[model samples]
Target chain A: MARATGCLAVSLGTALQICLLFGTASLLSVGGGNSVVPEIQLRAVDTYHWLSAAQFGDLFAIAQAAPGPSMLLVTLVGYKAGGVVGALLATVAMILPAGVIVHVVARFWQSSSGARWHVAMERGLAPVAIGLVAASGAIIARTTEHSPAQLALTAAATLVLCATKLNPLFLVAAAGIAGWLGLV
Target chain B: MSRDRPSSDVSLGRLAATFCQIALASFGGGLSAWSRKVVVEDRGWMTDEEFLSAMTLCRVLPGANQVNLAIYVGSKLRGPRGAVAAVLGLIAVPVLIVLVLGYLYFRNGSVPATQSILRGITAVAVAMTFAMAYKTGAKALRSLPAWVLCAASFLLSAVFRVPLPVMLAIVAPVALWWAWPARPDASP
Candidate 1:
């Protein structure tokens, strides 16, 4: 019983920590969830020891597979730590701050126009967002690339995606097959 | 800008419902297409040109593209309150579903069927992301300089493994220099 209580407390604490980290990250994630991968990997694998490196990769896969934002990995990690309550807590924590900020910003943005700083900031942020997106693609490729077949698939997919009008879902399906077949 | 323009005939409730439908239907991450289908094709809420303009604005704004989309659609249909209602409705169901699923998933790490489905979904998602990147890049890369910047950014990050923020610091100033409005007499 004491052990159970101790575990519960630990889980709750972990959930809270996850929320704070993710909340801050969410606000800063102007480029999207992929941009936060480096930080997430560092915390989840290096700092927390909640999961091994391979497990983090699996969680990332699960997050991408699921709908909504990729930042949903926070809920997955919280769930692993504590369960439903933890998941709920973590999700709220991660989403609420950014939601509120966006809401407020949208409201204000509607009325205000021709603000110099606002224009400057938007102009300044665009290239940063572009760079971050590229970095994120690279990071995902680095982690997911494991073998000759996987590398080939990744290159082919990237090239096809950049060059052709073919639907991306086909490539993903091919990659999954490769993964299942131990080709990657 | 007409601040006193009357609201569209679409009721707030209907607007909210439309947003919810979009959220639920966005199983894969092709939200831009899904949004286009719903807002422009199905509902006739906005014209294609209007939808595209709003999408551009949303992309430049901070926040999830979908959330920004809800805001734009809602604001167009009604006003500020409509925007709030639409965004809330869009997120409410997804959050609830994710919370419940998170509970089950945490309690039990992975079930075989679920794992298989997720694996399939992951592949689809990767494809969807690539498609989005390609589409967006085509629109954004209008000039040779812009294309060069894109290539430089990609190569720097992918090959050199430079941190994202650092790369941003390097590329942003260059983009600014290129995008900065020219003086009247400075034109060639």
Candidate 2:
């Protein structure tokens, strides 16, 4: 077992780090959680060496499957780094600052019809966010599309989703079956 | 655009419950679809147009779109307190579940069935994202110039591998100009 430090110190330090990660990711998340995956990959796999690339990918997949935001990978990383205490610390840290900020902003927005500059800001942001989303898709495709079979699966899934009104779960199930069969 | 009177009919409790439902039911990144259903279709919390506008606003905000969305929806329904309640409920429940699951997974090195299920979900998520992009783009890309901006940004990011922030800095201003041009009457 890893050495057990004072609970308060571990909690506080882990919480602080989690807050910083969540805050920076939130502020810079123009395109959403998917857009921030590369940054998370860099920090978790490359910088800290907490997990290998494959492990990180697996964590991401699990995060997506579970629920809530895709950013929940933070919790898994924290767990790996420090255990249950770390997971709690990270979860609280990741949420608190952004929650406060949004609450404050919501209050201000409620009372005031936002100024023209605020409207202008949204207009300016929309395309940037869209571009970021596109970039995120490209990055995920690059990283995950390692084989011809995987590429075909991705392409077929994309086409099915685009062309038909079929629920997306069907595509996912088919791909999983293929993966299970070692087809991709 | 119209500054209508705020509706007093929507209850805070109902809104909070709806947000919790969204959070819990939103397995496999289902918040976007669940949001469309609850807010726009089921609850009539907001009109379809209002829901779309809120989605856009949430996307640009500095948080998970779902969390940001809870804030927007709650605030719209009641006030700041409602926003706080909604967001807290949405996050706390999910966090608890995820933490417990994480603990279990840590103890056990792998869960094969879970892994397989996620592989399936990932394939679907990718497709869903693409479809969402197309739908959103089609609605927002009203002009030829707007399409040009979308195409250019896509190519620059997808093909050239330009960093996203830099690409946005280059394309966003142009898109703004195209979408809401300066009116002759308003200009000095």
Cα lDDT, all candidates: 0.58, 0.61
Best prediction by TM-score: 2
Candidate maximizing DockQ: 2
Estimate candidate 1's alpha-carbon lDDT, on a 0 to 1 scale: 0.58
Residue lDDT tens for model 1, A148-181: 5555555566677767656455665665565666
* TM-score of candidate 1 against the unseen true structure: 0.61
TM-scores vs. true structure, each candidate: 0.61, 0.69
Q: Of the true interface contacts, what fraction does each candidate have?
A: 0.16, 0.38
Q: In candidate 1, list every pair of residues with a backbone clash.
A: none
Q: Write the per-residue lDDT of candidate 2 for residues A1-184, one digit (tens) a residue.
A: 2423222335465456555665676566664556667876786677656567886777776676676766677777767655666666666565556656666775565454344433443444444444444555666667555667666666777677667767555565676677777676
DockQ of each: 0.22, 0.34
Evaluated on chain A only, model 1 obtains a TM-score of: 0.59
